[model samples]
Structure formats: structure tokens, C-alpha cells
Target chain A: MSWLIDPFADFVFMQRALLGCIAISLGATPVGVFLLLRRMSLTGDAMAHAILPGAAVGYLVAGLNLGAMTIGGVVAGLIVAVLTGAVARFTALREDASLAAFYLISLALGVLLVSLKGSNVDLMHVLFGTVLALDDAALTLLCAITTFTLVALAMVFRPLVLECADPRFLASVSRWSGPVHFLFLGLVVLNLVAGFQALGTLMAVGIMILPAAAARFWANSIGGMLAVAATVVAVSSVAGLLASFHAGLPSGPAIILAAGTLYLLSLAFGPSGSLAARYWPRAHLEA
Target chain B: MALRIRDLTLGYDRHPAVHHLDLDLAPGSLTAVVGPNGAGKSTLLKGLTGELAPLEGCIDRGVARLAYLPQLSEVDRSFPIAVGAFVAMGLWHRVGAFGRVGGQDAARVAEALAAVGLTGFDKRPISALSGGQVQRVMFARLLLQDADLILLDEPFTALDIKTAADLLAVVQRWHGQGRTVLAVLHDIEAVRRHFPETLLLAREKVAHGATDTVLTAENLFRARQMSEAFDDTANVCVRPATRGAA
Candidate 1:
């Protein structure tokens, strides 16, 4: 019990880090669930990579200011999203092709920008994260983002579900689909930008996606998926932070690996999951 | 409310799928838009439902509220939703996006599920449902819509005969209620059986009027011919004879 409770109780930084991770999970996992439901998992990954240049530019301009980097990352990600959508819409290219093209170009630009301005230590920090070192400003930002995200998510949940379920049906019935879609995309960008503070761009997607993917193996409804995803994120974050402190491991990778491990375990052992469904009587389609 | 179309050319990617169509759907009118494959039935349906904008002309949707049921294939059955919740989505128009679904809304959802013969399936995830059951759930949603006009596209394409007949009864019930209904259907005999008015369409309108008058053997032959040679740029449609109001 001491081993479990000592790290959070003794260190204020650890407590803040734990809260930060939980906040990111609460916001990011639901967005992650929607991304998976819409078959846009790769799109999330692409957007993550695309945010690098913008954050790097922010670092060059302001030297790791959380607000600047967040705005830059969001702008970069939005540009990629919009450009991908536009190319797919106007040109003969499909969405996947357009996304791949735009993300690759943006990724290259990000690498170039970061290398040009930041040192190797700064580069490592940007690529990984500094969760255990969250100051007051960073914690406040994370909490505010989480609050907005949860409220916006509650507002959009129904329309967003309908949008994901059958966009054409929603379009026929009401004029709400397009706004709901842009807002959903906006939430994704916001979560990634906020997650960037603690998890870094590359690992933020892991925090967003892995828990949601694991939850799918366990839950039967969207609301259940969201709840289960948040739980998985909480467990993963706490376990990963404790392991990092005790075993002298990297915090970001440890958290993601913890999530990945849970995903594998759920895949095998979840009651209605793939492996269990295979060995048992029920079909996986019930999920 | 009536739906009026004038010289509507609707399509995708600059190619006109439905070219130069003029039509009128009076308030409370029930008409079937029937045609062969690639005959622009879906394009026209999409245009009427306001899903597709006219590429060349205009449509006056006299009603602000309408409902549309796309083909079953258009919906993702893999979504993790229950039959009851899916039907409840139709109540969004009344309850709003963030509004709570109270006992009244829940009762309506139950009545709709019961109407479609899906009683006591409130919590069953939709992915486990059969194709016909999924179609029924779509009908249940449509029932909850309570719109002034309804547009259905290929509603019975893959459904079994029983499911088709049962769902068609809902269409008849809507007609009985004096709500306008426009459906894009493939079964010609079924169209003649139930729909009082029919519009036989090729890339162009072949005939439009009473089901018995429009679905003639010659008009059916012309429709099939137009579908076969649809890409011919030199194609000039020459109606054998103009049916009334065509």
C-alpha cells in the first residue's frame, strides 16, 4: 500500500502529473473512440505527425511556451485536416492518399524546423514529454482544456453519434451535420494540442487511441466505450507514472506501453472481445 | 407541402446523372420514382431530399421539415448502438441534440419499435441484428420523424419478402395519414401494386402519371435501352409518345 500511495502523496509534481494524465484521458479517449468509430484511426496518427512543424516553429519563436506551441500545433493540424479534405474533395485523389501526402510533407517540414532551431535536448523533450515536471501554468491549461472538452463532448455526443452512424441520414433530416463534423474535428485538434503538453505529439495519439481501442474489446455501447476508455486511461497513467518513478523509466513511453499492454490483455481476455468471442459462443459483432 | 422541380440536372463530379428533369409533387401525394439501374432514380431522390444540390436548375422544397431513409448499405452496421437508441435518434428533431430523452420520448421509441415488430429489443446492439431487422429499425426511426415529406431510396433492396411487405404497410399508413411520400423502388410489379402514381425514368423521364399508364411495356423497354447506352454523348431522347404531364 505504501508503494502504491507514496509517490503521489510525497511529491506535488507527481500529483500534478497524475491529474494531468487523467485529464488528457478524459478528453482524448472519447475523441479517440469517435475516430475509431469513423474509421479515421490513421487520420489521428497523421494529424499527430503533422503538428510537429507548427510546435517546432512555436519553440523557435517562443522557446517551449505551452500556449504558443499548442496554438501552432493546432493550426498545423487544422491545415493538414482542411488540406486533406479539400484535395480529396476537389481532386481525383482519395482521402487516404491526400492525407498521406499532406502529413508526409508537414512531417518533413517539422523535422527540418525543429533541427534548425532547437538543441538535441529540446528535440528529445518535444518528441517525448515532461509529465512529471508539470508547473502550475501547465496544470491549469490542462484542467481548462479538459473542462471545455467534457462540456463540448456532452453537447455534441448525440449529433456526433448520428453523424458517425449515418451522415447522409442526418444531412437529409437537418442542417446540423456539417457544423457537428467541423466541431468534432476541432475537438480532436484541441485534445491533441492539450495532450502535447504532457505526452508530446507522437505519444499523445497513443494516450488517445490505445485506451479507446482497448475499451472496444470490453464495451458494447458508445457510452460504455467512452467510460471504459477513460478508466483504462486512468489506470494506465497511474501505473505508468509509478513504474517510471520506481524503475527509472521514461514517463511518456512507459504510459503508452502500459496502455498497449492493457490493449493486448483486453484483446485476449475481455468477455466479448476477439479472442474470447472466438473461443466462446457469442459473435464479436455484438460490440 | 409540395416539392417542385424545374429542369433539375443532378449528378456527381460534373457528370449529369439526372439531366434536365421537370417535376411536381403535390402536397400529400405519394409517388414512386422507378427506373432501371443507372437510370438516375437515386440521383433524383437525393435531389428531392436536399442531399444533392441541382447542378443546372432549381427545386422548391415547400416544406421546411422532411425525412429521408437511405438504402441500408449507406448505414454502418458496425456501429455500437442498440436498436432502441438508433430509433431514438429520430427524436433528435423534437428533443434537440443535447435535450434529455424523458419518459415521453422513451415511450415513443417503444411504440415505434413495437410498430415495427421489434418489441422488447430495446437493448440489443444493432450489429447483431439480421438484415431485415435492421431495415425494420430504419422504418421505426422514420416513424418517429413525423415529417411532412419523406424520401426513401431502395428501402427494400435486400430485404426478404415479408420484411418488404411489412415495411410497405408503413408506407401505406403514411399515405393514409395524408403525408407526402416519394420512394425510389426497383420492384416494378410491387410498384404497380401499391403506388397509385409512378414516374418511370431513364436518364430522362420516360413517363409520369398513374401507375397503370406510366409503367407500360414500351416505356419499360425504353428505360432499359437508355440505361444500356447511357454514356452515348450523341444520344438524343425521342419519346415515342408523350404521356400526360410527362
Candidate 2:
């Protein structure tokens, strides 16, 4: 039992890891809600995979400066958005097909760049994540990104959700949905790039989407969903940190697994509207 | 002023759905566009509402402000939005970015809800509402928009008799208040009983004028018969009204 507190107490690194987890979780959850509501979850997945090549390019060009790398990643994300939009407009192909094409190509390009640089280990760290290895710079970047993400969401909460909930109304009134959508995509890209040093490509997106998806099972209002999603994200981040410390596992995967566990729990036993709500109608009566 | 369309042509991606069609909407009147299933009724509404650009010609005295309600079946209802929040969307044009919902906005939302006979359902989740109830919520939203011209596409689809009657009453109320309404409907009797004007469309305008003159057997037969000039995929078929059934 003391061993639990021992890891936390013995090292500043552990404390930083926990903080980093909180930051990434905070930044990504509401973002996930937007992505899910827009039916862009698959697009989010593609963006995550596509960031690998950009990260490699950034690393090669700027030699691990977090800002430069993030810029590179965001540029890649915008390219994905533009390419997907263009393909959908010009061809008979759908958005998903375009995303699949872009991401798969990006994955190949990322591998090739890493091989060219002869930095296989660093490349693995970028892909799989290295949150435990995060220095002071990465920590600062995560904090700043989290702050910016939350503030932007606060500023545009209504229009963003309004656009998703009823685009026809926006169109009738001449509100441009494209810029808002692109801005959202840009923020998601930033969060992905900022979180990569800590959670890696796969885990960062998983953390963003899974907790929000779980939150959907529990709430019927935007505020309620946002609150629930943020809480689930915070709780799962802590659990993942503790589990990773004790069991000698990678922090990112452990955090994702923790979030996945919460999702399953939400799926199974969350109150009235949850999956548990479906099987146990009598259980719902009490809530 | 009357609404006028001058030789308007429209299409999706250069494939013309409405070809050199002209129309005039009399102010303060209710007009129903009755047609076969593919008769370009929706396209006409889209063209009128400025959603689809006219490939040729232009609109004159098109409503300075317009409200459009899409088919109930066309909307995705899974979003977790409240009735009040849904109606509040109409006030987007009035509010500034990042502005809080003030007393006035809230009042407007409440008034819109009351107008639709749903005054107490401000907090009700949209997904929880019945089909007719949902349509009423949309009507409330349109009320909040308060546009001079209202275009509804198949607003009565899947509704019961009472709900449809209640909805038509709401439309009549709008017309009484001097708002112009162009509603796309499939029921011929709903048109005859409720609306004073009608437009019959089949890729092109088959008839446009008084409901009785437009709903004649000759025009009905022409509307049902597919256009021979265009290929099957290129032609827009408006479904013939199942007359007097409603």
C-alpha cells in the first residue's frame, strides 16, 4: 500500500506524468465530442495516423523543438482536411475513402522518413509515445495547449454545437460553417501534436474519443456531456498513471486502457440511459 | 411586393433539376407545391431559399428574411438538444459571438415555444419528443426566426391526423399574420382544403396558379408521365398527389 504512495512521493517525474495526463485529457475530451457529433470520428482517426509523417519531418527539420514539430503536424492536418474536402467535391468518392487514402499514405511516408533519418528508436517513441520520458519543455507545451483549447471551446461553444446540431439554420442565416469546421480541425490537430510527446498518436486520440463516447451514454445536454466527459477523462488519467507506475507499463497505453475501462463501466453500469440502463429497467427506476 | 422568379435555372453540379422555370409567389398567401415524388419540389424550395444558386436569371422580392424547415425524416434526431436550445438557434442572427443568452433571448425562446403550444417544454430533450411534437418544436424555431417567407419541405410526413391538422392550423396562423408560406406537400386534399395557391412541378413547371386550375386531370396526367426529353437519371419526377386522401 505504501508502495503506491512511494512512486508518487519519490519522484518529480511521476508528478509531472500525472499532470501531463490531466492536461492531455482536458484538452482532448470536448474535442472528441465535437468530432463525434460531426460524424468525424473516423476523420479524427485518420488525422491521428497522418500526423506521424509530419512529426518525423519536424524532427528532421527542427531537431525536436516542440513548437516546430507541432507546427509541422498542424500543417499536415490541414492538408488532410483540404485534400479530403477537395476529393469529396471533385470525385464520386466519399470523405472516408479520402481519409483512408491520406492516412495510409502518411503512414508510409512517416516510416520512410524515419528510415531515411536512421532514427528508428526515436520514431518508435513518437508513434507509441514517451510520456514517462517527457522533459520540462514537453510539459509546458502540454499545459499551454490545454489552456488554449479550453478557452477557444468556451468562446465558441454555442456556434460550434449549433452548427453541428442544425446546419440548415446556420445556412439559412448565412453563417459560414466551413471556417468553424476548419478551426475545429485545426484545434484537434494542435492537441494531437501537443499530446504526442506524452500520449503518442494512438493513445492521444483514444483518450480524446473514448471518454467523450462514454459520457454520451450518461448525459442528454451539451453541458452535461462536456462535464461528464471531462470528469471521466480526469479520473481515467489518474487511474492510468497509478496503474502504469505500479505495473511497469507504458503510461499512454495504460491511460488509454484506463479510459477504455471506464467506457466499459459506463457501458455496463452508468445510470438510466447507459447500457446498464437498457438491461435493468428496474435499476433505472431508482435513478 | 410579390415574389418573382425570372427564368430561373438550377442544378446540382451542373446537372439541371429546374430548367428555365419561372414562378411568382403572391404575398401573404399560402402556396403548396404538389407533385410526384421526384417533381423537383424540394429543388424549387432550395432555389427560392438561396440554398441553391440559380444557374441563370434571378429572384425579385424574394423574402428579405426566410425560414426553411426540412423534412422531418431528413433530420438526424440523435443530438442531445433541449427544446428551448433548439428554438434559441433561431436567434443566432441577433446575438453576437460569445454573447450570453440574455433575458431578451430567453424571452423570445419562451414566446416561440408558447406560440407553438409547447410553452412548458423548454427543458425537454429533443430526442424525447414525439414526431408531431418534434415538428412543433421546429415550428417554434421558425417562429423565433420570424422570417417574412417560410418554406417547409414535407413538414407533415409521418404525422397523425390530429397532429397534421394542428400543424396546418399553425401554418394558417402564420398566413393570418401576413407571412408568406410555401409548403411542399404530397396530399392533394390538404392543398385544396388549406392552401389557396398551388404550383405543380415535374422537372419543369407543369402548372402554376390557383389550386383548382393547377390540379386538373390533364396537368395531373402530365405530372405523372415521365419527361421523354431527358434520360431517366437526369429527369426529376414529382410524385403525383394522392388526391383527397387526407
Give the top-scoring candidate (lDDT). Answer: 1
Residue-by-residue lDDT tens digits, candidate 1, B6-84? 7778877666788778787888888999988888988887787766888777788898678888764468888999989
Q: Per-residue lDDT for A47-139 in model 1, tens only?
A: 888899989999999997888887899899888888887788799999899989999999999999999986899988888889988888888
Regions of candidate 2 where Cα sits further than 4 Å from its true position: A1-6, A283-287, B12-16, B72-74, B226-229, B232-246
lDDT of each: 0.86, 0.81
Off by over 4 Å in 1: A282-287, B12-16, B232-246
Please tell me how candidate 2 rates in CAPRI terms: acceptable
lDDT of 2 by residue, B39-151 (tens): 77888888887778887767776567888897633345778888898889887667745667789889999988887779899998888888789888888888877789889
Number of the top-ranking candidate, with TM-score as the measure: 1
Candidate 1 i-RMS: 1.3
- Scored against the true structure, residue B87 in model 1 reaches a CA lDDT of 93
Q: Could you tell me how far off, in angstroms, the CA of residue A128 lies in candidate 2 after the best superposition?
A: 2.2
